[model samples]
Target: MARTVRFHEIGGPEVMRLEDLETGEPGPGEVRIRVEAIGVNRAEALFRSGEYIEPVKRLPARLGAEAAGVVEAVGPGVSGFAKGQPVSSVPAFSQNDYGVYAERAIVPAAALLRRPDGVDAVSGAAVWMPYLTAYGALVEVGGMRAGDVVALNAASSGVGLAAIHTANRVGATPIAVTRTRAKRERLLEEGAAEVIVSDEEDVPVRLLALTGGRGAEYAFDAVAGPGVTDLARAVAPGGTLLLYGALSGRPTPYPGFDLGMPALNVRTYTVLETTRDPGRLRRAEAFVVSGLRAGVFRAVVDRLFPLEDVVGAHRHMESGARFGKIVVTVTG
Candidate 1:
């Protein structure tokens, strides 16, 4: 029997319960994994709280998206993966729900990616979602190119860090925006060409100055609402504003005239849209794996908690004290 975390109802972290269940062998084109680490993302919180666009099915839904483990069993028709091979997967939403928080999980072969040699389970689990989102937004959707100036809001987040690293890899200058002044030096060290303390500095003014009065060529905004308007203002002529997240829990108001008149493109993207396309997913995974293997990108784990203490982990993530990814270590 596999031990898994299940939630009977949508509400606070207290609603989550740990239970024991029998896990069957992987079906065709699937693989069973002995889960080591599971990533805790904001999407999980939204799903648990019933705030996400997609509705959670019935009671006792398992919760999680990405995980890292060693392959325990490879189902029929699965090739190239051996027993005990280290792997990571972003399971399909339906199966992903209760499985990733369990001691063992079954996932499709297509979702499976081998972990890089030196990457640990925790870091490996952290890599897929954020980096994939970053890659899709910046390169695939935004069409970021060399010498482009990119501005990323919530620049201390996992996705933000991924954006900075992606921009660096593409030979673009990444300007990171953060509300906290303390994270400036760390952002710089992480490949941000410049860091803007949004709460302290005039964002539009500083952005214009940084771009030599031209403004950033691309803006990645996670914090929506009034801040998005400012972000649109800082976009250079013919620039793109990719709004991927709404951390503020409010509606984003945009000045349609400003965007339309100057031919500024305002695009909203979700990881699902990008990953749903097999070819895009393949490209994203390949690039991310290569970056991990080459040490061009590193997963930042703020803290790890036992699966039993998931409530505490969720609270910590909600507290906004964490600067990077938070993970849960699932024990067998």
Candidate 2:
């Protein structure tokens, strides 16, 4: 039997429960992995709370889309991966369809990628969603380029830090924004050219000056609140403001007002848009793997919890007190 985390209701962290289930063989084009590390993402929390893009259609739903472990067996019609292969899920499918927060999981073989050398199960479980989300927003959709300047809001989150690393990879400059000054210095030390304490600094004023009178070409925001007004103002003429999340729990109030002024483009960006496309997915995978092999991309683990501590892990992610990825290690 494999221990799995499943939620029978849509509410707080308490809704989750750990249970044992009989392990099954992989089906055609599928691979069964004995999970070693599970990544804790905000998406799961939102999904459990029934606030995600697609509402939870059923109950007793499993949660998680990223994990790293050894491939115990491969199903027919699958190639390239065999028994004892180290691999990780790429978040290419819905969590409802393929949740990896279990001691073992049956995942589509196409969604698996070999763990890059030097990246252990802990860090391997941490990279997929964060890096891919940043890549989709900055490169695939935003068309970020060399020397381009980007403003990253909620700069202390995993995606925020991944944006910092992605920007560095393409020779772009990143301005990290946090709600307070507590994470400013730490963000700088992690490759941000500049840091903005959103509560203390004028985003537009500082951004314009930092870019030498020209605002950032890309404003990657995870906070979709009233501050978006300033973020819109902080974009260069015809620049793009890509909003990805609404952690503030407040409605965004900017595009309607900033419609005509700077002629900016405000749009919603999601990792799914990129991961679902084959070409873009391949590009993202290659880029991230190359960066990891080159030691340019890094997965910073804030904390690791045993599978039994799933509730506390979810609580920590919701508390906004973490600086990097939270991982849950599984033992069977």
Candidate 3:
């Protein structure tokens, strides 16, 4: 029997239950892993609370999409990966189709990535969502280049920090935006070229001044709330504003006044676009691997919880105080 995290109803973290589940052998083109570490993301919290993009269709649904472990079984037609090889899970399918918060789980063969050297199980679990999301949005879609100025708000989360690292690696100037000055020093220490405190300063004004009268070339936002228009306004002409997450639980409103500039592009993005496409997925993997080998790509683990403490883990994530990714260690 395998221990897995499942929720019968969609509501709060307390709805989650760790149960002894019977995990069967892998099917065709599938791989089974003995999970060691699970990445805890806000998306899972949103998923369990019935606030995600899709509704739960079945009861006792599984949770999580990121983890690292050694392969325990490989089904027919699977090549390259052998038994006992170290691997990590990636988001290739919807959470409703598969999840990783378990001592053992089976996933599609294509959704696994080899763990880079020197990266432990916890680090491997933490790297997937943050780096891929930033890479897909900044490098692949936005066409970020050296010396380009990119502004990122909510600059303290894992994705936010990953964006800063991405900009640095590409020789771009990353302007980190925050609601307060609490994480300013840390952001700078982590390679942010400039830091803007949204509460104490005028964002657009400071952005323009920092860019020599021209606004930022691009702005990456995770908080889609009333302040979206302001962020859009801070973009230079022909620039793009990528809204990736709605942390504020409010729709990103496109006010009438800001629509005057036709060159400014406002769009949303997802990592699945790169994860599912073979060529793009390979490129993304290579990029992440190079960064890791060069010490440029890193994961800051905020805390670790035992698999059964998933409810408390979600509660801590809701507190908005963690500075990096949280991992669930499955010692079983």
Candidate 4:
């Protein structure tokens, strides 16, 4: 029996329970793994709180989308993976279909990526989601290029720090925005060209001045709400504003109409757009692997929790006190 995490009802971190269940054999197109580490993300917290974009479809629902493990079994028609091979699961499948928050879990074969040599379980669990989100949104979708200026908010989170690294890798100048000043130096150390403390400075004005009044070529926002209007105002003419999250938990408005319909392109992106597409997934994996090999990409884990402490992990994530990825390690 595997100790898996599930919730009978939707609510907060305390709602989750680690219970033993029969981990059955993998069916067709499925792969069963002995999970070594699990990546905790804001999306999982939002899902547990019943505020996610996708609603819970049934009771006693499972939780988790990203994890690292060693394959123990592969069902019929699975050709590439073999037993004992190390792999990492990405957020390519729905949480309702498969979850990795367990000692042993069955996930879709398509979501599995071979853990690169020298990548530890903790790094494997933490790397894929954040780097994929940053690369997919900025490089593949945003078409970010050398000499471009990209401003990103939530600068200390895993994805936010990954954006800073990605921007530097592509020769783009990254400006990080945070709600407080405590993380400014850390963000600069992570390759952000500038750090804007939103509470202390005029973000739009500072962004404009930083870019010589032309504004940033791209603004990648994780917090989407009324404040997007101010962010939109800081995007250069003909530039794009990419919204990937709703951390603000408020309604987001399209600022084009409010800003006199300037030549700003406002768009929304999700890592699923890349991870769910075979072609995009292949390209993204290659890009991330190259960056990793070059030492340009690194997983920053802020804390570690045992599988039994999953509730505490979720609480920490929800508290907004973590600066990087939070990983839960499974031990026998």
The lDDT per prediction is 0.86, 0.89, 0.90, 0.95
Model 4 CA deviation exceeding 4 Å by range: none
Q: Best by TM-score, which number?
A: 4
RMSD list, candidates in order: 1.8, 1.3, 1.1, 0.6
**For candidate 1, what is the lDDT?**
0.86
lDDT of 2 by residue, 106-126 (tens): 999988888988889999899
* lDDT (Cα, tens digit) per residue for candidate 1, span 1-332: 98888888889888888888887899898889999999888888888888776778777788887899999999999998999999988734553334587899888887778888888999988888889999999998888999999999888888999999999988999999999788999999999999999889999899999999998999998888877877788899889989888898998887557456675888888887666678888888888978887789889888999988999989998888787799999876
Given candidate 2, what's the lDDT at residue 315? Answer: 93
Off by over 4 Å in 1: 91-98, 258-260
Q: Model 1, 5: alpha-carbon shift in Å?
A: 1.0
Q: Per-residue lDDT of 1-332 in model 3, one digit per residue for the tens?
A: 99999999989989999999999999999999999999998889988999988778788899988999999999999997999989999888788988899999999999999998899999999997899989989999899999889999988888999999999999999999988888899999999888999999999889999999788888998998988888877788888899889998886787436667557888888778888988888998999999999999999888999998988889999988888899999996
Candidate 3 runs further than 4 Å off = 255-259
- Root-mean-square deviation of Cα positions for candidate 1 versus the true structure, in angstroms: 1.8
TM-score of each: 0.94, 0.96, 0.98, 0.99
Candidate 3, run of 10 with poorest lDDT: 254-263
Number of clashing pairs, model 3?
A: 0
> What is the Cα-based lDDT of residue 51 in candidate 1?
77
Which model is ahead, 1 or 2, in terms of lDDT?
2
Residue 200, candidate 4: alpha-carbon lDDT:
98
